[model samples]
Target: MDLRHFRYFVAVAEALSFARAARNLNMSQPPLSKRIADLETELGVRLFDRTSKKVNLTTAGEAFLPKARDAVRAFDAALRTARLLSPSHSRRLRIALPAETSRNVLSDIVSRLQQERVQVHLVEASTADQQDLLTAGEIDIGVIRLPVEKQGLWASASLGQPLGVVMAAEHPLATVAKLRLCDLDPYTLVIFQRRFAPGLYDEVLDLCRAGGYVPHRILHATRMTKALLRTESAVAIVAERLAKRSGEAGSKEFIWKPLEGSPLHWWSSVICRANECVGLTRVAVDVILASLQQHEGWVPMPRSVRAQSEDIRPIEQRVDSVNAH
Candidate 1:
């Protein structure tokens, strides 16, 4: 079978629904079903047990899945290696990005890479997942959230912005110009998930306590606070610049306002395996730095040895003054 068939099977197996898999694969459900049927016929075994209520992988399917993934990975690795050795091959770079990464930052990076004649493949993942992928040699670069594990990795934070409050447009507090920690105490608030951003989540909670204000109630959002904002009247905390730059600014259903006193910030960084910083990874890092330097509030990491989340405090002092508007 071809890589296309492998991809189709993987997508269906992961989703456990032909309709969902078809949507993800950008194809009609009927054709996807036919492909699966043809594959089953070829293998002389049913891969998935189709039921009216749900779809599930058979024992045979489970046995084949991991091998299929390895096959795909090996093929891709071989193709990339061939391209690296070929003089006429165009340059390609794979970058892992968190789902909530800023659109402006991604746009700028893509723009710069295009100008440099490099093809970019962006993989959406969490900060932790991206780190794992980077460590495994699956991706050349990762632009992920801060507080990532730094062992065996070279990482630098370049973007930092004050946290903002997100609320439904109809919420009374949405009309307010700016909000203080105490102002949000009366409403239920949604914080970014601790698993996804433990440092930022704790920082926000600590800031509220320092102000002597505890929220009436608090909840957690999975990947982005924007989804919570759409359905809940409760406020969500997120980076103001990211909300605007990511096109959430145009949403008539939600509004984001800068926090008063500006005590908390969201940070992003570029990370890769420490020892593999030659060739494409090195070039990707330079491209990231150049793109970040052009932005107004982005702070370029120091050129010295790699720094961690603790090192960001000093940089915050300098950037806070500039971003306090």
Candidate 2:
């Protein structure tokens, strides 16, 4: 028989009722019954035991049920691969890299994908915007800061990115060996808008309060530039990787000082739709992780933050055309 025979057999086997299976399959019982009979004839066995009152699987049906289920699953996976991706979007992964993420991290990821002959289209988004884009299927994956609301998504293990303070070199605190959060109590805090990372935003404030620094005023800016980053009246608490790119760091007019105790351990992760991640999508994720391994300022994600709902497969288990191109 063909896939249809297996499909019909599985439906009948799972329901254990010819009439119920036929109704669920949207067909009349006669054809469904005949198809099951034909399958039994082709296999040279009686696959089911039928009586007036109820239905049950015979020994042969019980033996064949698992095989039939596997066949159905394989067929559906193949169908999704062939039909779900539009022609224009095929093999071209649309990705969102948030503003806080280092551009070089993305560049390295693209380089790895190129080695495997996969193309990429990139957009700069905040972690918050990336969340919306991923839900809408407008993009396949995103590199964002955690903690994300974990529903309908799968995420890679996080890499910890340490945070530090950036201010003008002439600022009073710049001379200290290591700065504490509380030391900046006199100055305003220049930070990213809360919308960029809602969870991180609230977490940072709590951390400041815990550290004994509660700013009287906070300035929220969407983009961090040299003009805003190294202001004398405020200090920006950001990742050192990001601070170096603010255009003033190279001039030596801005200094980045590590926060004592490393209190702000920013976490980064790659996320994608749980149900839709497969084939090339998985390959892309593996490649991205491999690329991140080449950079600094990343450590393994803590066990506590990983979502319990999805299995985050080990890199070796994921399929990637690492050698085949």
Q: Which candidate achieves the best TM-score against the true structure? A: 2
**C-alpha lDDT of residue 120 in model 2:** 93
lDDT of 1 by residue, 1-325 (tens): 5677777888799889999899766699998998898888888998999999899999999998998777766776676567557664447788887775556668877877777778888888777567656544578788766644446566654566567777888888877787777887777788756766565566668778777558777777645566666665678777766566656655787777887887666667667655555665566776775565455366644322333444333222222121101
What TM-score would you give candidate 2 relative to the actual structure? Answer: 0.65
Worst-scoring 10-residue span by lDDT in model 1: 316-325
All candidates' TM-scores? Answer: 0.59, 0.65
lDDT of each: 0.69, 0.74
Q: What number of backbone clashes does candidate 2 have, counting pairs of residues 3 or more apart or in separate chains?
A: 0
How close to the true structure is residue 181 of candidate 1, measured as C-alpha lDDT?
A: 74
Clash count per candidate: 0, 0
Please write out the lDDT profile of model 2 over residues 1-325, one tens digit for every residue. 8999998998899889998798757699999999999999999999999999888899999999999888876776566466456675566788888765566778887887777677799889878778767654568888777666645667766767788888887888878986898998988788888877887787778888889889898888746545665554578887776667765455578888888898887766777877666777778876776666556467664524233222233211223323322
Query: RMSD for each model, in Å, please?
Result: 8.4, 14.6
Point out where model 2 deviates above 4 Å: 1-90, 222-225, 229-232, 303-325
